[model samples]
Target chain A: MTLDFWGLGLQAVNVLILVWLLTRVFWRPVAAAIVARQTAAQALLSDAEGTQAKADAALAEVTKAREEIAAERAAMLASAAQEAEVAVQAKMAEARAKAEALVEAAKVAQGHAAEAARKEQTRQAATLAVEIAGKLLARLDPNAVQGAFLAQLVAAVEGLPEQDRAALTRGGTLVSAAALDDAGQARIAEALGKMPGLTFVVDPALIAGFVLRTQHVVLHDSWQSDLDHILKDLRHAA
Target chain B: MNSPLDAVALFQIGPVPITQAILTTWGIMAVLLLGAFALTRRLTLTPGRRQAALELIVTTMDTQIRETTGAEPAPYRGFIGTLFLFILVANWSSLIPGLDPPTAQLETDAALAVLVFLSVIWFGVQGGGVAGYLRSFASPNVVMIPLNMLESVTRVFSMFVRLFGNVMSGVFVIGIVASLAGLLVPIPLMALDLLTGLVQAYIFAVLAMVFISATVEDGTPKSQKET
Candidate 1:
């Protein structure tokens, strides 16, 4: 075999040129594109992660706010309930006080009404008694009635205390329910007029007996006064 | 009969002589350059069919380079891929009538081996530094330094002889059979020659890879070096 050194040298140079050309034309750009794509994909993933983190944070904040609002609402509801209870209690107390006051007023009015009714009953009894006495006296003999009354007057005058008798003996007036005869008047004047200025007054209100009133003393022995005392005792016992 | 020993001188350029093998080599280079230009014209991040195919080819070669050398394939990809493509295309060109394959010539095979030899040194120095590469010759013992040195030269020579002998014999056998059997009978031989041509191209590329890796690895055992 013939060895051509010049041909070998040219072929080597040709191979070197082809190798340099192919590296420049093809391999470098393709590799660069691949690396760039990988970098871009990584960047996109990082951005997605950041967005997810932000979303999680915002959700947590919202949850916290909701919990706070719920607590506030609960507090307000409790306070409202307390205020409602207080207002209800106050209304109940006021109503109870008003009821007690109404009861007290009714009791006072009932007492007053009872007192008035008793007074009216006593007045009616006294009038009926006076009417019956007057009828009975009209049926009796005048001399006999005057005699009985004179005896009672003398007895009542003698029963008085010494000081009251002395005061009565001073100038005084005698009031009686019935007109008296001259003898009867003379008897009464003699019984009561130890001092002088003795006068007699006929008063229909003193139904059956006399009332002697002196400047310092008064003595009443009348049906109306006796009935009024009896009625007062009855009220006291009740 | 076309003598496989001699490269036919086709023309000359001033003092530099141009031959048929050089012309054929130029044509191959032009076709490769034009194809690369067309494929890369509108490269997109999203690839179409043609770009996909191109990427597959590039990636396959890169993987091979990485596997063979146990190094980053980037620097080695261009030279290794170019050698494989040129030899493969040159050997297959024999299918065309009246056109001799460039690899069938002694000069082309020698030139390929020379480039491989030079690349081995370049990569070795780049990996190990010149000093370390020189020191590797004295490995296993300084007494074997001469034998190791002779082994490097002979290996490169064997690469040249192996490729040239296989391709030239294929062509010569096909030619002799075509003449003796009057055309139709030589078809089987031609088909067999196609297989032989492909196998020879693969052997040439693989040997070149082994030689370059051996220098870079420096003190690897003989079995690992073969792998």
Candidate 2:
């Protein structure tokens, strides 16, 4: 093999030139492109992260608002229920009060009507008793009624105290519904004593009996008494 | 007859005589430069088929550099890639009829070796500074400094001789065999020659990587650095 100095020198120059050219042409641009693409990818990832955070925050707010609205609705429903309950209670109470008042008014009206009926019944009973007594008295003989009343009057005069009978003999008149004959006058005089003047008063209002009037004492013995007794009994029964 | 051992002169420029090997190197350089320029002129974040293929090639080279050097691939990428491509193209040029591989010439192989030798020194000094790089020769002991220096020169010399011998022998054998054996018989040998050429190119480039990486590897030899 032969060594050529010129060939070696030329070859060296060519290699160096090729190295410089390739470095300029190929390496720098490819590296720059790769770095730029990586940077853009990183930026896109960062933007996506930010958007996700915003969306999450908005969703949280919406959830909270929905919860609040639900709570408000519940509160309103509770309030409405309470109000309705109160209104129902008030209405029931009012209805009860009105019913009680109506019952009281009806009771008062019934009492008044019962009182009026009792009064009317009492009046009718009194009038019927008086009419029945008058009819019984009209059927009786006048002499027998007069006799019975005169005997009762004589017995009552005899039963009087000595001092009372003695005081009645002074200036007293003997009153009667009928004119008494000598025997009746004499009998009454014997039982009572003659004093001052003898007076014979005929008062038909006494029916068929006698009445005594004295300064200190008076006495009743008449058919009208029997009628009063009958009226008293009938009133007690009614 | 034996083929001529010397590179033939094609032209001259001033004191420099441009040879056939130099002219062929220029044609190869032009093709590579134009292709690179066109591919890189309009680049995109999204790559086309041609661009994707090109990136695949570059990525593979970068991965190989990292595995070979155990250092970042950025600083050494351009020079090492250029060396591999130039030698690979030169070694395979013999496939063209009447065209000889430039690596078969001693001057061309010598020039490639010189470039690798210089790059090793440059990268070493850049990595460890001048004093630190000089101190690397005395590794294991100060007594080994002279031997280490001689080893450095001889190893670069071995690179040039190895490339020149393999490619030249392959071409010579094919030529001699074709003259004696008929045309079709030498085809198999030519095929074998093609395989040999690719293997030799790979070996030369890998050896260059080892020599350069040795200088930059924590400013120590590969054996000591591993230890």
Candidate 3:
């Protein structure tokens, strides 16, 4: 068969018309719809990614908050412990001060008690010597001895040295003796009368010895007084 | 020239002969059209036997369109399916006794080529603006514009010649061979002709897909990159 160019051209025109009709009727809407669906899908994918990012950020924040709360709790506990330690220290200091004050007060009270005991012992010794001397003098004749001793003590006082006699005359003396007989007492009184400044008084509590009290001097001749001096020295030494 | 077939003398307009090949082809086309019309008359969602067969063909065409165009096949499904079915029928018609394939004619082959060409232009214009569609001819580089335009024209010409030459050669060879050899010896040739018919139909469909894809969007070949 021969190739017919003219017929082919006519057929080509017919084909062109058919294609135009088909595109207008069918293809346009399908293409548009497909593009729309793809756009929607992409938008949805992006939205999901955004949501996931937000969730991740929120989770991180929550974790941070949890850690912060734990740190705060630890700090609070440490502060509480420090406060407790301070309170305990304060109590301990107060207790120590009170104990130290009580100890000082006890020492002062002990010193006061020791001084009172020493004064009491001295007063008891004086009373005991006076009673013993009285008992010894009662065995002798008290009236006879008193008269003789007075005359002797008067003579002795008259014979004393001028300075000593002068001091003796300034203040009267109290004399206590128990060993002197009546004659001896009288002789001592005569001697005291001869001395210009001498004077005498007698007491039987001296227990066989004499004691003289003067303005400037006290001569201790009582046996109980001597014994008390020796006993005090021994107690101190011991 | 001597009469080519026994039926050549039947109709004449002046000096030109109306051969049996043309008559037989027209008759076969009419019958096929009538059969398709009958099958498609009452379209149903749940198909009967004829509709089921037609649906299978449509589905296959839909898949081809999707693979080539990279879009939903539903939109171009009907038109591409119809075009394929028409070409398949035309090509196979040659296998019938005393019937020539309509596509073996320059007019028929050129018609299909022009259909592909015009579809390319129409879809390109629709997909992008007229400015964008014309810009495809200047692709790769601006200096390539003239060459690109020549290629576009040549591609259409190739479509025309390729289908024309292949179909015409088949018909020519079969006629010459059958004319020389009697019926018994020509059976193998006839079988080869049948295979050619199916091959030509497939080739035409594939070429149509290639042209259609070229016209869509900026007409750049699809890239492997994810959308």
Candidate 4:
């Protein structure tokens, strides 16, 4: 067996040179590439994480703003609803008051209309009674109706005051519902205590009995006159 | 056929006689250098298929170194990776007609073993210091220092013998078979030699890495004392 130290030395030197060359060409460049890629990836990941954080922050802000808007909207809606309710109540009260006033006015007008109608009816009844009495007296003996009226007139003259009787005794005109016969005039004048200048005037509206009118007094003793006095008393009472 | 132990000078350069093994070694170096240069020409961050393939090779080497040493692969990567590549290419060069693998020669194998021995010491010194590298021999106790020192030389010598013996035997066996059986009979043996060559290259590289890392780790605690 043989070993060559010279050859061994040469081979070792060659391998060492090869290792040096390959290191420069292969190992360093490739390792640098890997390291560069890793660094770039880390940078990209950091940027992405930063962007995600920003996005999350923006989203949170938006959510908070939306919540605030919703709360404000709810508050405004509640306020508006309260105001609307108050307005509705006020309008309702006003409408109720107006309705009551209209009812009161309608009741007053109805009462007035009822009073007018009752007055008209009463007046018509009084006129109807007077017309019926005139017709009834025309059917009766005229002298008997005159005698009954003369008795009423004599009672009314007796109840007169002495001063009023003295004033009524002065000259006056006699108004009769019809042309007065001498006996009717004498009866009315005797009941009136001798009213002077008494003239008998015929008035169809007075119907039959005589009415003596003096300067200060007048005496009525006729069915028509009696009915007229009754009608006037009913008007006053109504 | 020449003896497997013989390295006949094919030529001479001044006082230095150049053997076939040396010539083949140079050719292998040229091919590796050119190929490396060409492959790495257009390296980009975004790699194409060629770049991906180159990266895969480098990444695999780094991974193997990292796994084996448990230290960073950068300092050891160049020497270990080149050693493996050169050995593998040299061993497989036997596939060429009438060409013997340089690793089959005693000188080449011895040179590789010597380089491994030197690298162990270098990395040990680099990881610690000169005194720390020397202190690696005293691991466990000072009593075993002499044995550890002897074991270090013998271990490197054993590596040289193992590589030379395996490659030389395979080549010699194939040569004997081809000479006796008149060619074609050595084909199967040649195929076996390919597997053996690949295994030897892997073993040499792994053993070199282990020896270097072991020394570095062993010397580390003593490094502070030396510093």
Candidate 5:
């Protein structure tokens, strides 16, 4: 039995051709697909890692911002506290100043009231002294006082205008504290000779002096009139 | 019956005689080439079930090549993977009714062994140089050169004889058993033949890889031998 040399050559050629065909169709393509899948997986992993890093960075930024906000909030609280303290201090000072003003004003008002009361007392004391002087003058000797009053009256009459003296002489009455003696009356008439028609009238309320009266002319020269004028000046001073 | 050792020509093309083995080899080649094209038509990064199974086969081939040779699988994948797939399919082709497996033929095994021998030389030359490939025969010392050269031919011839003997014996024994006993009696033997076919295919592919790598390693400088 002989070997089939032609079949052997043909089988070897067939296998060689199969190897070349399978290389292109099977082996290379499958290996390439595996490589491609691996590459894609690697890319996805890289992207995921990048995203994680970004998230970490963003978290760090947010944390930093939160810390800053906390610090800012603390600063605001401190500032508010400081401002509140200043406002409280200012309010306290204002209240204290107002209280001081009220107290000072009250003291000033009290002092002014005391001074007014003292002045009032002084006016009252002056009025009482005038009244006492009036009483003391009244207790003096009536005739001597009368004479002195008449002398003063004559001197006042001589210094008067002619019309006044004539009006007194024509119808004027001499009001006296008591009925004057003839000597006093004659002396008064001589001193005021133009007033011959002067009448003598007794008015004890005059105290110890006289007033000469006419229709429009009256000369007051009495203790009561002097005391009344002193009282009016004291009232004005008060 | 014609001897399994003999390949009687069915026809002739001028000086070349076309036998049943050649026709069967052509059918196997056509089926494998067309089937491979169809299987790998739609390869993608995301794989379908078909693509996954295909990738599994290629990956397994790469692993075996890597494990056996301790070298990168890319350069040897086509030659080594094709040898294993073709031999396994050819060995199992005996399952078809009335068809003898192509590996059972002495000439087919011899042709396979001759291709392995040629590939060893080719790969050796590519690894180092022509001078380096020639020098690999004189490895260890000049005295071993003649023995080494004779051993190379004998080793290849032994691989051919081993494959032919196992496949032919299984087929011949099954034929005799079927002729002597009933049809069902040969089933276990046929099953054993299937196991024998698988083991022989594996052994043949591994031996081819070892032989090729031995030549390449011997020819190459120690520094450049990493490839």
Candidate 6:
């Protein structure tokens, strides 16, 4: 309306006082609350971001640990396999050595058995020949001049060639008083044939002693050839 | 001629007929105050039937202040609300049979303009500092310094003239029309007068809010310079 200068001034003063009172009473707390609300919201957002970052870091750490454990497990498994292979190889080598030793022991035992069997066969042959010669000697004469004549003949034959003398020396002569049968003489002749240049002769005074002679040498004794042959075979077998 | 409205005779004070349009204006103010006081005596936050009408007016003003100032309505609530209520009452006062709108006079409009001018300077000084208040005129550029200073002076004058001219023209036109036509024919013209009165009042309050907001800014040209 139409207020004069004084009235208008008073109205202006009234408006100013009213505005001041309203601002002080009503607006201050509302403004403060708004600012506080904004600040709290910002703080809460930052805290959420920080917590999310921590969770991500923890997840990454957990993943890293799992990977490391997996790698360690793989390494352990590989090491175990390698150790198992080494153990298997060692056992194989030990078994190979044991098998080789067993084969060598079997060879040695086989060689010993073969040598003993040869010696036993030689001994049995000598004993049978000696017994045969002893029986023949008992049937021969006890005493006679002829026997002394025979001894003289044998001494003459002992002076023979060295090649023929070695052959007669390998098997000493066995003398028998009994006459040889056809088969027995044939066996004696065949044995003498294996020793060439040696002769087998029997004297009655010698009693079953057979003399093995060459042109210049004679070997005389009962069962002497059998014993000498047996001794020679035994030395060869050993 | 004959003077159409016989303005000197029809408008008067008690024994002295005011040649300056003062008596008609005071009568309007008195009536408006009486009516407003009658409408809202026992004020309530929730509002009864009669109080609800008053609350609607206050709320409309509150919304306008909040939109224009871009600040909480609570901060400048009282000033904006009072300005709106006072202007509304003054404008509506002209609807009475024998009353003239007081705001139609140069003296009354200039007084309201001066109030706005003073409030702008006062709030500016209070918002920042003396230095900050002076710096508001120097903004945009150093070249704008003189222009800004002149603008502040011109703004008060513009406020004064706009409200004065608009209200006075409406009254003058209506008075002329009433003289030409008879009483019965002037009814529509009187309705138009009511609309114009409300518009002028709203313009004055809105312009006052704009001035107050401009002055209250921090006056730091760093932001304007960046733009």
Q: Give me the displacement of residue B60 in model 4, in angstroms.
A: 2.6
lDDT of 5 by residue, A1-238 (tens): 7877777787778778888888887788878887788899999999999999999999999999999999999999999999999999999999999999999999999999998998889888988998799789889999889888988987887788877776766777888998988888787677667437878999977787888788897788998777777887887777
DockQ of each: 0.40, 0.44, 0.12, 0.57, 0.53, 0.06
Give residue B14's lDDT in candidate 3 (0 to 100): 59
Give the poorly placed runs of model 1, Cα more than 4 Å off: A41-238, B182-192, B219-227
Quote fnat for model 2: 0.72
True contacts kept of 5: 0.80
DockQ of 5: 0.53
Span of 10 residues, lowest total lDDT, candidate 3 chain A: A22-31
Model 6 misplacement above 4 A: A1-238, B1-46, B218-227
Off by over 4 Å in 4: A40-147, A156-238, B14-17, B42-46, B165-199, B222-227
lDDT of 2 by residue, A39-99 (tens): 8888888898898899899999999999999999999999999999999999999999999
TM-score of chain A of 5: 0.62
Which scores higher on TM-score, 1 or 4? 4
Q: Across residues A22-87, which tens digit of lDDT does each residue of candidate 6 receive?
A: 344333333444445557778888999999999999999999999999999999999999999999
TM-score on alpha carbons, each prediction: 0.57, 0.59, 0.46, 0.74, 0.62, 0.44
Could you give candidate 1's per-residue lDDT for residues A1-238 as a string of tens digits?
5677788899889878988887777676555555565677788889988998998999999999999999999999999999999999999999999999999999999988988887777666656665676566556664565467667877788777877777776778877777767777767656654534657888866555667788987777765556556655654544
| lDDT for predicted candidate 2 compared with the true structure | 0.80
Give all candidates' CA lDDT scores: 0.78, 0.80, 0.62, 0.86, 0.86, 0.61
Indicate the residue-level lDDT of B131 in model 5.
80
Q: Is candidate 1 or candidate 4 better by DockQ?
A: 4
Q: Report each candidate's C-alpha RMSD, comma-separated, in the order given.
A: 9.3, 10.1, 12.5, 5.4, 8.6, 13.8
The number of clashing residue pairs in each candidate reads 0, 0, 27, 1, 0, 16
Q: In terms of TM-score, how similar is model 3 to the real structure? A: 0.46
lDDT of 3 by residue, B16-73 (tens): 4444444544564456556655655665544578655655655566677777768767
